[model samples]
Target: MVLSDLGRRINAAVSDLSRAPNLDEKAFDSMIKEICAALLSADVNVKLVGNLRKSIREQVKFKDLPPNTNNNTKRRLIQQAVFDHLTHLVDPHAEPYKPKKGKSNVIMFVGLQGAGKTTTCTKLARYYQTRGFKACLVCADTFRAGAYDQLKQNATKAKIPYYGSLTETDPAVVAAAGVARFRKEKFEIIIVDTSGRHQQEADLFAEMVQVQTAIKPDQTIMVLDGTIGQAVESQSTAFKQTADFGAIIITKTDGGAAGGGAISAVAATHTPIIFLGTGEHMMDLERFEPKAFISRLLGYGDMSGLIDHIQSITRDSAAMKETQKHLAEGIFTLRDMKEQITNIMKMGPLSKVAGMIPGLGGMMGGMSDADGTEKLKRMIYIYDSMTAKELESDGKILVEQPTRMTRIAHGSGTSVREVEELLTQHKVMAGIAKNMGQNKQNMQRAQKMMQGPNSKQQAAAMQKRLQSMGGAGRGMPGMGGDLSQMMQMMGQGGGGMPNMAQMQQMMSQMGGGGLGGLGNMFGGGGGGGRGRGR
Candidate 1:
């Protein structure tokens, strides 16, 4: 079974417990059996599975509990026991290697051929670059033809500097030279890509040892193939003998039946799983957390990760401050709208963002990055047609003079109706800006409210306030239509969808309160919070 299948089965078992009118010995045993079956099917070790079952039984054993403990408490303990046991299945509880900020932290990549080691080297550099590190890539894989070319192409595209030799045939020499060059250049993080073989050839292990001795890398990461199933254990063990692996990255985890096996292999080695390769893109690598990973696997969205995504895009305090100044000035310029959309796009695919919401995924569901990117392009094209004065004035020409809208549509090669629609969107946001600028205090208060314990409820109330302030996104094209469709979907599926929390949390991250009206689009986020909807 794949990671997703494991989640599905476990979720079904939990649902069975939640629905049962009575909690009995048979019911508890049935849940345990289901858990064991899921674990075994995922290629987890039979011994580990037996231990998990035994641990759960011991955890819920009633004879050790106080007589006053109720059945509900007993049931909750059983669920907690299962969660705790599952968490330990793959988490080695070892600290991952961390790169020092000011120092040159060298990372060496080692894995079997075709395990995606080269790709991961570039991805790792990009990850560090996004977080403000001066990261560079070095290609030491002389065994793999075109390794330098591949690294060069990725480095050039990311605008990150790189070092490699087209003529170098010795992996150790290449690695040593690259590390020396990057360290002299004052690069903060230097990543070295080493050679690999189809099989664990003696030469392969010897080459790794030679490279390891030469560079003495701060950390050596093993890029494991998640599709290899239970065999990952043996591969990880073999690599462990070659060198000290500080961490492991499981690649091709987007969907692979043996991903569980690959994960469980963490128990076989000293290294912890640090990242998971979810897609082909460099941005697809996610920092792995056992609890959060298990949560998403069970179809529960990852909110903390979503918040981190927003923070990554909005980390520039100065940019957010400028936006706040514009919002406070109550000028919802066309350029401001473009910047908001641009920031959102930079956070990644809209479909993925929608998934962060519990049920709103259906509304913006199945929207690929291509589709979202195209929509962004069209909107920007319209902005490109607008004059500097027009953009700054928030499309006043389109609002006051109908002919200006016509001219823009002809210039943009879009329908006059489309231009009008875009202008209408600006107006909706502008109204929110006006309200927020007028009542910025309440919005700021709401921003702090987010850190409170009942953030979900506070966010919901904030949404209602935004709706009341600006007619709740009524005028935008399909605004009302989408809301009705969403309401219908929620009705069809029992109404506990948690859409409000998802919508509000995201909108609040967008810039707080003035954009709360736009949160109407997602049905949350307007909770008296304000973002830099300048």
Candidate 2:
């Protein structure tokens, strides 16, 4: 039920305006009220929301109407205007790999502890290698224990050359050696994996400046944890002010609600995110596409980049293509759902996946915050409790049995109510999938809007939206357009796994029918309280 908070705001505004037959003064005023409320609740900056409201008012009042204009036209125009305002906030310059030809690249990874800097380096190297560049890894983190060993291990896996000095205490020397070796080896790209920071590490940044000078790198990338929402902007600024960052890599995307904040950070730093590390694997990387990303935030469709990553690793085009066909056709079953979840687990955590989408988070606004994340952990526990047959079979048992529901509730430390909620959500999603099959245009338009320049700007607007919402945005993909389309797709088990909606459904039904009720009974309601659903 995670929808983009921003998208929901826009939709709410439209819905309010649509309630009236014409753009009367009162209707316009009411619409503005809804817009202001939704934006503010989304954590958007108050001043920004105010300015947008003013523009909306002007468009409705002062602007000239076209010949034969009606309330519908007015409403649509207002929708577009609001969308434009939101879009303007996304920072498009954050996309990194749209490189200039013949420009040697120097990218560096920086983030807090446990942010997966070492793994990011290998993924970045693999990214460059795929682009036909000879890449080198610089283990400049001579201080952090096991930092050097970790980078080297991933480098070996990628089969890319690397340089690090075990004896030298000076990281500068190690950086210099790595650079010199890179040049000698004719490497077109060099990635420096610095030690993880303890927030605003001035000395470390100074050292990074020196390393950048030694290499004169064309691009400097700040690696960020997907789970570090509000902290991402400040941390990125610290690095940018020191080393002048060129792009970003939002890593550990399979982790938490950090994806929303990470996207918001892109606008704050005025730099494009070049890549996203969906998993720890070398191939779990993708070029940052604002539209695709925004569409995901809104719960529009399966991520093409995610699919591409899977295809690269699986090398089973036929299976993938067939799966997609089945998904689009709404032919999914519990068996398909199990396979989908297994693959997604292999890729990374569910929360990270949820934040990448657009409107779904808004719907899920009630569940997430800057400091806490329990969505993914809950999902893992629920799924762990399922037997293979249970995962593959639908309506076999516990679909309506209170005793079974109680058992599941106890087993998962969740509630029977929560288990039922999950089932209800799944039913809703299956309906969306069926609807998506019928309304191809809305889905396509949503997809296009998400991948285009609008998405980049909307992401920027999201940062501004953050202050309004109070909690950072979190949710699943594709929530606004046609719920039934999403539901049908879920039934077919799209790209990553059974859609989050289906997962919720299956988990709920299973829990309610068996020991799954334990989760809700103990934890009070499982994760069913994710958001305030309409």
Runs in model 1 with CA error above 4 Å? Answer: 62-79, 311-338, 346-351, 355-534
Candidate 1 lDDT over 1-534, as tens digits, reads 237677778878966886678777788899989988988888887888898889888878867788787776766676667666777776788999899898899999998888899888888998888788899998988887888898898888878898888887988999899899999989999999988753449887888899999999999999988787788788888888768788999888766565667766788785688888877877777777775566455444556666666666666656566666898876677878877766767766665565454434444445556755665666676777888888778677677898887776667666676676667667778866765576566455555555578755775676577567653453222222233233322232122222333343444434322333323333321122121122
Error of 1 at 421 (Å): 10
For all predicted structures, in order, the TM-scores are 0.71, 0.54
lDDT of 2 by residue, 1-534 (tens): 212455555565666676776676677777778766765554444565677788767766634676577776676566555545544545454446543335446666666778787888888788767666778799989878888888888899889888898899787777877877776766778788777665556777677777777766666778877765556667777777777777887777654342455655666678887777776568778776554454343344334555555555445435445545655765433334434444544554433443442222333444433212344344444545555665544423558555765665566666566656555444444444444454444445444544566754643454344324431222122333233334344332122222334434434443422212322222334543333211
Candidate 2 overall Cα lDDT vs. reference?
0.58
**lDDT score of residue 122 within candidate 1:** 88
Which run of 10 residues does model 2 get worst, by summed lDDT? 512-521
The Cα RMSD of model 1 versus the native structure comes to: 9.1
Taken over the whole model, the C-alpha lDDT of each candidate is 0.71, 0.58
- Per-model clash counts, in order, read 14, 104
lDDT of 1 at 373: 64
